[model samples]
Target: MIEAVSLTKRYGNTVAVDNLSFSVKPGKVTGFLGPNGAGKSTTMRMALGLDNPTSGQIRIDGKIYQDLKYPLRKVGALVDPRWVHPNRSARAHLAWMARSNRIQAKRIDEVLDAVGLTAVAGKRVGGFSLGMSQRLGIASALLGDPEILMFDEPVNGLDPEGILWIRNLMHRLADEGRTVFVSSHLLSEMALTASELVVIGRGKLISQSTTDEFVARASDDAVRVRSPHLQRLRGALTDAGATVHEVDDAIIVSGMDSANIGETAAAHNVVLHELSPQQGSLEQAFMQITGDSVQYHSDLDEAPGQVLASGTN
Candidate 1:
C-alpha cells in the first residue's frame, strides 16, 4: 500500500502541495483526480522521491522511497514517458533500468512482449510515436516486476485498442494483490477503470472513497417523468416544491423521489407513460464537486454569433 501523511511541497512563494494525506490499498485501482494545475504531478513526483517535499512525507508500504532497498522492485512508476534517453533503443532503455535495480536482463524481453513492443524493441525511442513511447514507458515500469505500479496519463496518446489494453492490464495487476494508482484526465475512462478514487483540488484532499459513493454524493437524485397530462402534472409537481425541467415529451424532476413523483401524478389524476430515475455519471459528479476548485474558468456562456458581432465594432 502507498500512504501519505501531511505531505507538503513548496516552490518559493507558491505552494504546490498542501498538507495532504491519503492511502492507496492493495488489490484495488485507485484513481488520482484533480483539475489542471491542482498539484497532482507534484504529488506523484514526491511519492517517487523526484521532488523533495517541503514537509511531512509519502511512503511506499511503510518506508520512504529513498530508504527502499530496491525502490524500482517495490514501486514502479511511469510519471513521464519521455524521461527515457531518446537515442537509446527501447530494449536498451529497459535494460539500463533493470540493471539499476539488479533485475534480470532477460526480464526486459518479457516486459517488452507484455506491452506489445516486442516487434519494435530494437527501434530508437526518439523515432517512436507517442503511443509507442507510452508502451515503452509501461514496459519500463513493469521491468522490475514490482508489487506496486503508478502511472500518470498512461492512455494519453493511446488508441482505442491500446486504451483497453492498459485498462485490462491495471485490473489484472490489482487482482493479483498489487497496488495500482493512476492519474488521468479521461474522466469517462477513469469511471470504467478505477473502483476507488482519490480526488483533490487546490493541493488539498477533496474526497477519497469508492467510485460509486463519490458519484452518488455529488449527484442529485433526479427522475424523468412522462405523462399524457403534461401540463397538469407540471403544475402539480411545481406546487409540491419539486424543481422540474421540460425536455421534449418528458419532464425531469429533482428534489423529490420517484415514488413521491408517482404519487403526486396519481393524486393529480395524471396518466403517466414513463418514469425513470437518472443516474449521475462520473463527469457530472466531478464537475459538480470540483466546480469551485478549478483554478481557471472558461467563459463559454456567450453565443459564437454574439461574440463575433460584438468584436466587429
Candidate 2:
C-alpha cells in the first residue's frame, strides 16, 4: 500500500501542491487525475523521493521511500521515459540497474519478456520508437518485481494497440496483488480503464473516490422536460415547487422526476411535447467537479456538446 499524508510542495515563490493527501491500495488500478499543471507530477515525484516535500510525508509500505532497504526492489516507477540513455541497448540499461542494488542479472530477461521487449533487447534504445521506448521503461521498472508501481502517462505516445497493451499490463500487475498507481490527464481514456480515481485541481484535493462514486457525485440528478407549451410548463413547474432552467424552448426541472412532472402537467391541463432524461456522462461529471479550476487549455474539451446546447438555450 501507498500512503500520503498532508503532502505539500513549493517552488520558490509559487506553491505547486497544497496539503494534498491520499492513499493507494493494492488489488485495483487507482488513477491519478488532474488538469495540466495541477501538480499531479509534483505529487508523484515527492512520493518517489525524487523531490523533497516542503511539508507533510509520503511513505511506501510503512517506510519512507529513501529509507527502504532496496528502493527499486520494493517500489518501481516510470516517471519519465526519456530518462533512458540513447546510446545504450535496453538489456544493457537493465543490467546496470540490476547491478545498482545487486539484483540478479538473469531476472533481466524475465522483465524484458514481461514487457514484450525481448525481441529488440539488443537494439540501441535510440532506435526504438516512442511506444517501444515506453515498453523498455516499463521493463526496467519491473526488473525487481516491485510491490508498488507508479506510471506517469504510460500511454502518452502509444498507438491504439500499444495503448491496449499497457492497459492490460496495469490490470495484470494489480491482479498479482501489486499496488498500481497511474496518472493521466485524459479523462475519457482513464474513465474506461481505472477502477478508482483521485482528482486534483489548483494544487488542492478536489475528490478521492471510486469511479462509480465519482460519477454519481457529479450527476445533476435533474430531470429533462420538453413541451410546445414551454411558458405554461415553466409556470406549472414553478407553482409545483420545482426549480426550472430553460434550455432553449425546453424546461429542465430539478426537483421533480419525469412521472411527477407528467402528472403535474396533466393535472394542470397542460399538453406535453416531449419528456426525455439526459443521463450524465463521466466527462460531464469531471467538468462539474473541477469547474473553473482546470489548469489546462481548451475550454471546449470538457463538454463541447453542452457548450453548443447552452448557447441555444
Candidate 3:
C-alpha cells in the first residue's frame, strides 16, 4: 500500500502540496485527479523521492522511498516518458536500468515483448514515434516486475488501440494483486479504468473514495419519465417536491428515484411508456466538483463580438 500522512511541499513562499493524506491500496486501480496546478506532479515527485517534502511523509508499504534497498523492485514509475537517452536503443535503455537495479539482463526481453516493443528494441529512441516512446516508457516501468506501478499521463500520445492496450494492462496488473496508481486528465478513460479515485484541489485532499461514489456525490441523480400524459406527470412530480424539466417528449425528474416516480405514477393512474434512471458521467462530476479548484479560468461564455465591442469602448 502507498500512504501519505500530512504530506506537504513548499517552493519558496508557495505551497505545492498542503497537508495531503491519502492511501492507495493494492488489488485496485486508483486514479489521481486534479486540475492543472493542483500539485499532483509535486505529490508524485515526492512519492518517487525526486523531491523532498517540506513536512510530513509519504511511504511505500510503511517505508520511505529513499530507504528502500531496491526501490525499483518495489515501485515502478513512468513519470516522464522522455527521460530516456534519445540515441540509445530501447533494449540498451532497459539494460541500463536493469543493471542499475541489479535486475537480471534477461528481464529486458520480457518487458520489451510485453510492451510490443521487441520488434523495435534495437531502434534508437530518438527515431521512435510518440506512441512508441510511451510504450518504451511503460516497458521501463515494468522492467523491475514491481508490485506497485505509477503512471503519469500514460496515454498522452497514443492512438485508440494504444490507449486500450494501456488500460487493459493496468487492469491486468491490478487483477494480479498489484497496486496500480495512474494520473490522467482524461476523465472518460479514467472513469472506465479506475475503480477508486484520489481527488485533490489546490494541494489539499478533496476526496478519496470509490469512483462510483465520487461521481454520485458530485452529480445529481435524475430519472427520465416518458408518458403520454406528460403534463400531468410533470405536475405530479413537481407536487412531490421533485423538479421537472421537459426535453422533447419526455420529462426529466430530479430529487426522486425511479421507484418513487413509478409509485407516484401508479397512484396518479398515469400510463408510462418509458421510465429509466439516468446515470451521471465522470466528466460531469469532475467539472462540477473541480470548478472552483481550477487555477486558471477561461471566459468562454463571453461572445467574441461582445468582447471586441467592450474593448473598443
Q: lDDT of each structure?
A: 0.92, 0.86, 0.92
Clashes of each: 0, 1, 0
The regions of model 3 sitting more than 4 angstroms off are 303-313
Give the per-residue lDDT digits (tens) of candidate 1, residues 1-313. 9999999998998787899999999999999999887889999999999999999899999998999989889999998888888899999898888889999999998999999999998989999998998998899888898999999999989999999999999999999999999999999999999999999988999999999999999888899998889999999999999999999989999999999999999998889999999999999999999988787554557554333221110
lDDT of 2 by residue, 122-208 (tens): 999999888888888898788888999999998878898888888898999999999999987677778877898989887899998
lDDT of 3: 0.92
TM-score of 1: 0.95
Rank order (by lDDT, best first): 3, 1, 2
Task: Residues 18-93, candidate 3: write the lDDT tens digits.
Answer: 9999999999999999988888889999999999999999999999999999888999999988889999999999
- Every model: Cα RMSD to truth: 3.8, 5.9, 3.7
Q: For candidate 3, give the lDDT of residue 119.
A: 89
Residue clash pairs of candidate 2: 248-313
What is the lDDT for 32 in model 3?
97
* Native-to-model Cα distance after best TM-score fit, residue 276 in candidate 3, in Å: 2.0
